[model samples]
Target: MVIAVVADIVGSRKLDDRTSAQRILDETIARVEADLPLAQQPLTPTVGDEQQGVYRALDDALVSLLMIQLRLPDGIAFRFGIGIGAVSAVESVHGELADGPGWYAARAAIDTVHAKEGRAVPGARTWIVGAPGQDEVMPSTIAASNAYLLVRDELVGAMSERERRLTYGRLIGRSQQELAADEGISQPSVSKSLRSAGSAALLDGVAALRGDSA
Candidate 1:
């Protein structure tokens, strides 16, 4: 089984320069994939505002998606829905099309995010769902993942643009001195921002997801 992802810009119509935003989104996706190298299919723009991709594991999806969230510039944000199941490709006149339970679960997961955003957790940007008829164990995994995602989205949504950048730099093994140099700030300031913005905790969480030691 593969992990399928569906993503769309958070506020596409409100952007003053949609073309520039799309360019940044594309570039950021490329950069993250180059760094992480986990996606079975790198995220690519699909229809209208949505993008699609697949990963071999749930941890890979979580890591790459979080990096995308952090790497994006200030004005652009994406909401993601991840699905766990099987995918089949159908030959089509327009090339090949992704069909099956995996894509359907991804669609349902995104719809869940949309509904949650409108009700209480407006910061909710990601959700996960498993295909129907999965083994009993899968539901528990999905529940745990959704719990983690809720907190992850809230913390990321609250971070300043600079905080996000700093977090992303740290994730890719960039030193504080290097990040400070790039940001035109001091190393101490970079440290302060990471601590104050809860980036340290977020990074720890990411490490745990990746099966790395704390």
Candidate 2:
């Protein structure tokens, strides 16, 4: 199955100057592409601060988003919509232009993220929509995925800048000692940052998102 990931800068219009945020988003997206290795098309900027990408696997798409979330500056954020299905048309030579149910579902998914859901928090920044299950399988799967994304967003949103850096390093498999050296801090401090931010849980959640567990 093909997975489509579409994302846009959060609060893009609120910034007095959007240039810096755009730069960060572009850099982060490019880093995600290099780290995650998109199968068909790399995540490409579509509009001012929006991007779309296609991956050969769901794991790659989810992991890429997780990486982006962790590495972003405190002032930067994006919402993601992930869709899974067959790729019916490749408009460009490199899968940059795609037209299919996957893209449609992905567009629908991001639309849901922007809409209010009852009394639920409005910033459910990541969501997924899968093609028809031939049964009722699609709804339940999407529900489970969004539930995780909601909690993950809240957790990341609550972190301090230092905590975010530590979490990001930890997510990418960096050792605490190495991270401490990079930050010019003692290992204990790095460990404390990760522990205080509940890094273990965050890392596990990301791993689970990639379907690495169960």
Candidate 3:
């Protein structure tokens, strides 16, 4: 089964510059895909502030979405819902429309994220759901992934922008010295920032997703 991802801007109606925010989103997706190249169909604007994409695997979606989160600038953010199942396209007057249980599950997942934010977990940004009756995913796996995402989203939401940039740099294999030079700080300071901000743990998570030995 393929993984379908649905994402929409966070607080889009309140943004001062919607056009610029869209541009940043587009550019960020381009950069992350260039570095990671995971999406089977790279995220493309669907309508309004929403975007959609497909991935061949769940790990790819998690890793790419996490990179996008870290790469985005302040004042702009996205929430993602990933659904696993079958997807199809049906011809429509306007164009070929995506229609299937995969998209339906994705919509449900995004709704879950929205509902979650109003509750105790305000930092919630990503979630996953498996289409009912789909043999591709098990309920236990989805539950565990959601548990991981809850904590992951909280840690990422708490990071300062600088910490995010450094984390992204490390994810893409930039050395601490290189990151420090870019930020105009000492290498030791860069290392400290990464450690203190929990970038190492995030990096380790991504590495684990990639099946790299710890």
**What C-alpha lDDT do the candidate models reach, one value each?**
0.94, 0.78, 0.93
Could you tell me the TM-score of candidate 3? Answer: 0.98
Q: Which is superior by lDDT, 2 or 3? A: 3
Candidate 3 C-alpha error for residue 187, in Å: 0.5
Candidates sorted on TM-score, descending: 1, 3, 2
lDDT of 3 by residue, 1-214 (tens): 8899999999999999999999999999999999989999999999999999999999999999999999998899999999988999999899989878888989999999999999988999999999878664478878988999999999999999999999999999999999999999999999898989998889999989889845
Candidate 2's displacement at residue 53, Å, is 0.8
Model 1, 130-186: lDDT tens digits are 998888899999999999999999999899999999999999999999999999999
| Least accurate 10 contiguous residues by lDDT in model 2 | 115-124
RMSD of each: 0.8, 3.0, 1.0
Model 1, TM vs. native:
0.98
- Could you say which candidate leads in lDDT? 1
Q: What is the lDDT of residue 141 in candidate 2?
A: 68
